[model samples]
Target: MTPITTFFRNLEAKCCASCGQVISEQAESYATECYTCQDQASTDAYKHYYKKN
Candidate 1:
């Protein structure tokens, strides 16, 4: 399947590519990583999951 970009409403949910966490529409616009996952990550280094702060 194609990579998830924008979130969809009234439809199926999406998962984070890094941590498998559920991605919410209100939490973001594009889909690749969830807020929690992204919060602990840098834009360039997102290959793995890590707690940054």
Candidate 2:
């Protein structure tokens, strides 16, 4: 692959917040969560932190 390709690939890659999976840079910049993480978060209520009584 060309250096430009590598650079763009690197530039476009991002790590997931929960699973540490590499996501798109656009997703990372535009969103706080990735696809997988967002899906999981939506289904898993326990994943969120609760306040103490």
Candidate 3:
């Protein structure tokens, strides 16, 4: 593959919020219970607290 093509392919892809894992390129939907959806700030705060413990 060309350098430009390879660069784009290596680019970070969309991901799921609940798991923080990457979603497939063909993924139809892109939202979880919170975070990436409605309760984004709250989800982030929870994750922060959970990680700090």
The best candidate by lDDT is: 1
lDDT for model 2 comes to 0.66
Q: Which regions of candidate 1 deviate over 4 angstroms?
A: 1-11, 26-28, 43-53
Which structure is stronger by TM-score: 2 or 3?
Answer: 2
Q: Candidate 2 at 29: error in angstroms? A: 2.6
lDDT of model 2 at residue 45?
Answer: 57
- Please provide, for model 1 over 1-53, each residue's C-alpha lDDT reduced to its tens digit, 9 standing for 90 to 100: 54455333435667899999888665445668888877777654654444453
Please give, for residues 1-53, the per-residue lDDT of candidate 3 as tens digits: 57976776666776666666665544335444334444667787899999999
Q: Write out the backbone clash pairs for model 1.
A: none
The C-alpha stretches of model 2 lying farther than 4 A from their native spots are 1-12, 25-28, 46-53
Q: Residue 53 of model 2: what lDDT?
A: 22
Clashes of 1: 0
Q: What is the number of backbone collisions in each predicted candidate, taken in the order shown?
A: 0, 0, 0
Q: Which ten residues in a row have the lowest lDDT in candidate 1?
A: 2-11
